[model samples]
Target chain A: MSALLAIEGLRAGYGETEVLRGLDLVVNAGEIVTVLGSNGVGKSTLNRTLSGVLRARAGAIRFDGAPIERESCAAIVACGLIHVPEGRRVFPNLSVRENLDLGSYARGKPRRAQNRERVFSIFPRLRERASQYAGTLSGGEQQMLAIGRGLMAEPKLLILDEPSLGLSPLLVEELFGLIKRIHADGVSVLLVEQNVVQSLEVADRAYILAEGQFAMSGPAGQIAADPELKRTYLGL
Target chain B: MLSPVILIPVLLNGLMTGAVYALIALGLTLIYGVLHIINFAHGAMLTAAMFACYFAFKTLGIDPYLSLFVLAPVFFALGYVLQRFVIGPASHGEDRNMLLVTLGLAVVIENALLVNFRGDTRTIDVPYAFATINLGFTFLAVPRLVGFVAVFVVAIALWLIMSLTDTGRAIRAVAKEKLGAQLQGIDVPHIYAVTFGLGTACVAIAACLLMPSYYVNPGAGNAFVLVAFTIVVLGGMGSVPGALIGGLTIGVVESLCSLFLGDSLGQVGIFLIFIAVLLVRPQGLFGAKA
Candidate 1:
C-alpha cells in the first residue's frame, strides 16, 4: 500500500526539554495505525508536531508525497490532514452547527453543506443538539462533535488524539465503532490513543511509544500478544 | 426642576450622545472579544482618525460627512496592518505582552499627534453644525440627530456582517476557541487582523460622526475612550449588542446625573452607580454571568 504520511528523524519539545526524540513513523493509505503510549510519552507532542502546531527541530514530514514539515497549520489542514485534538476542544460559545460549518472554513468549501449532513448522519446526536452551544454538551457529545468537525474537511487522513480520554467505556465503545465506520468510508486514520486493548482491536497495526521513540511495532495481533507489552502496558 | 419640558430634552440629548458612545464602544468590544486585550491604542486610533478627518476637511475640500467614505476603509487597512505585522508578532501571542505593545503604540500615536497638532483644539465650520431640529419641548442640533441615525445604520450593517457572512462566523469561532479555529484551518492571525481592522473601522466612523458635532485634539479621544471602556465592561467584554445597549444606558445615566448634580459631581454619580452595579450584578446588564 502507498503511504499517505511518512515521518523521519522527528524531534520536538517545549523550551529546552525534548519530548519527541528522533522518531520515524508512517501511515499508509486507507490504513488504521494506532500509536499507543502512557500519559507522557510524547503522544500529544507527536500529534502537535504532525499537525504543525509544534515545530519539529529535526524531521522530514511528507503528506501525500509533498513536504509539509514547514507548512503552516492552515496549509497543512488545507492539504486534507485534519487533527481532532485531545480534550475535544470545540468552540464553547458556538453552536454545534457553527462548529461543523467552521470545519469547512479552510477546506471542502463547495461541499460544506453535504459534508455537514454527512457529519450529522455519522453522529446523529450532534444533529439533535445542532443549535446548542458546544460547551453545554455532555462529554461524549463534544467528542462526537469534534470528530464530526474533522470529517467536515473531507480529510484524506484524520488524526485522533486520545478520543477516549474522558469517555465512559460504553461511549468509548461507540467512539471506536464510529472510528471504524469512518475508516470504512475510505479515509485513513492515525489514531493516537491510550486505551491499548481497544486500540489494538480496531487498528490494522500498532506502535508502542516509550522514552520518546517507538519500542515495538508490527501487526496489531502480534503486538497485542507480546509478553513485555502485556506485563508493562496492559498489566495483564 | 423635574418638569416635563426639562426632563424631555435631557432624555433626548442623552440618547443622541449615547449613539456616539455606542459607536466607540462597539469597536472596543469587538477587539476585546477577539484579542482579549483592552487595546490601549484604541483611543489613540480614534484621535488619529479625528485628525485625519480634520485634515480631509481643512486641507482637502472633503466634508466630514463625505469623509466617511474615505476614512473608514483607510483606518480599516491601518488596523489590519497594525495587528498583522506589529501586534501579532511583537507580543508573541502573550496577552500581557499584547497589552504592553498596544499601550506603547498608544503612547507613540498620541505623542505623534501632539507633536503635529500641538494641544490646539480644532473644529470645522460645516453649516449643518449649527442647524437644529426644533421639537416643541426643545431644539436638538441637526448634527446630533444625524449622529444618532448614522450610528444605527452602522450598527445594523455591523450586525448583518456578523450574522450573515462566512468571515463573521470564522471570527466568532476564533474568539471563542483559538485552537479549534486553527485545527479547522482558519488562519488565526488573519482573523485577528480582520477583527482589529473592523474595530478600527468603527472608530473611524465614530470619528466622522463626532467631528461635525464635536471637536478634535490629541486628548479629545481619551474623553470618549474612558467611557467606551466602561461601556465594554458594562456591556460585557465580547458582546456586540451588549456594547450598544450598555452605551445608551450609560449615556442616559450620565445626562440625568449631570442634571441633578453639578457637572463634576455628575461624573462622581456615574461612577457611584457603576460601582453599585459591579457590587450587585458583577456582570453588566447584557453580559453573561461568569
Candidate 2:
C-alpha cells in the first residue's frame, strides 16, 4: 500500500538538545501504525516534528508525496495532517462547541455543522456538554473532546500522541477500541503510546522507539511476541 | 421635568462621559484579550488619531466625525504596520517586552505631539459644538449626546465583529487559545497585527468622537490612558463586556462624585473605587473565572 506519510532520517531538536535522531517511519493509507516508546524517548517529539510544531533539523517528511518538514504548523494542519497532541490540549476557556468549531478552522469550515454532528455521534458526552467550558471536563471526557476536535478537521492521517495517557484502565480500553473503529472507517492513524500491549493489539504495524531511533519495527504480532520488548518496556 | 434643571443634565452628561470612557476601554480590553498585553500606548494612539482628525478639519475644513471614514482606515493601516514591524518584534514571547515597547511608543508619540503642537489644548470648532438640545427639564449638549450615541454604536459593532465575522472567530480563537488557534491554520502573526489594528481603530473612532467635546494636547492622551486602564481593570482585563460595563460604571461614579463633591475630587473618588474593587475582587468585574 502507498504510504500516507513517510519520514526518512528525521532529525529534530530543541535548542541544544536533540530529541529525534535519524528516525525513519511510515504510516500507510488505511492502516494503524503505533509507535511504542517509554516516557521521554522522543515519541512525542516525532509527532511534533511531523505536525510542523518543530522543524526537523535534517529529514524528509513526505505527507501524500509532498515535502512538509519546513512548513509552519498552521500550514501543516491546512493540509489535513491533524495531530491530537498529548495532555488533551483543549481550549480550557472555550465552550465544547467552540473548541470543536475551531478544529475546522483550517480546512473544514464548509462542513463544520456536519462534522460537529459526526463528532457528537462519536462522543455523545461532548454533545451533552457542548455549551459547557472544556476546562471543566473529566480527564477521560477531555481526551474524548481532544480526539473529537481532531476528528473535526477530517484528517488524512491522524497522529495521536499518547492517546491513553492519564486515563483509567477501562477508559484506556475504550479509547483503544474507538481508535480501532476509526481505523475500520478507513482513516489512517499513527498512534504513539506507552501502552505497548494494548497498542500492539489494536495497531496493524508497530515501531519501538528507544533513544530517538527505531529499535525494532514489524507486524504487530511479532513486536508483541518479542521477549525483549516485554522485559524492557513492561518489566515482564 | 423639574429635576433635570437641578439634576437631569448632570445625569445626562455623566452617561455621555461613561459612553466615551467605555469606547476607550474597549480598545484597551481588545488588545489585552487577544495579546495578553496591557497596551500602555493605546491612549497615545487615540490622541494621535485626534491630531490626524484635527489636521483633516483644519486643512480641508471637513467635519471631524465625517472625516472618520477616511481616518479610521488610515489609523488601521498605521497600527497594522506599527505592530508588524516595531511592536511585533519587541513582543517576542515576553509580556514585559510588549509592555515596555508600547510604553516607549506612548512616550515617543507624546513627545512628537509636544514638538509639533506645543502643550496647548486644541479644540475642533464644528458649528454644532455650541448647539444644545433643550429637553423640557434641561439642556443637553448636542456634541455630548452624539458622542454618547457614537460610543454605544461602536461598542455594539465591535462586539458583533468579534462574534460573527470569520476573522473575528479567528481572533476570539486566538484570544481563548493561541496554540490551538494556530493549529487550525490561523496565521497568528497576521491575526496579532489585525487585532492591534482593530484595537487602534477603536481609538480612531474615540478620537473622532472626542474632537468636538474635548481639547487636544500632548498630555491629553494621559487622561484617557489612566481612565482606560481603570476601566479595563474594572471591567475585567481583556473582557469586552466588562470594559463597557466598567466604563459606564466609572462614568456614573465620576458624575456622582462631581455632582456631590466637585470635578476636582471626581477622579480621586474613581481611583478609590479602583482600589476598593481590586481589593475585593482581584480579577475585576468581568474577568475570567479563575
Runs of candidate 1 exceeding 4 Å displacement: A232-236
Roughly what TM-score does model 1 have, to 2 decimal places? 0.97
TM-score of 2: 0.95
Q: Which stretches of candidate 2 lie over 4 Å from their true place?
A: B1-5
Whole-model lDDT for model 1 versus the true structure?
Answer: 0.91
Candidate 1 lDDT for residue B115: 96
Assess chain B of each prediction and give its TM-score: 0.97, 0.96
User: Model 1: DockQ against the native?
Assistant: 0.81
Q: Write the per-residue lDDT of candidate 1 for residues A129-182, one digit (tens) a residue.
A: 999999999999999999999999999999999999989999999999999999
lDDT of 2 by residue, A57-152 (tens): 998999998999999988899888999988878888778997888788887889999999988988899999999999999999999998988988
- List fnat per candidate, in order: 0.86, 0.55
Which 10-residue window of candidate 2 chain A scores lowest in summed lDDT? A227-236
What are the per-model DockQ values? Answer: 0.81, 0.60
In model 1, pairs of residues that clash are none
Worst 10 residues of 2 chain B by lDDT: B1-10
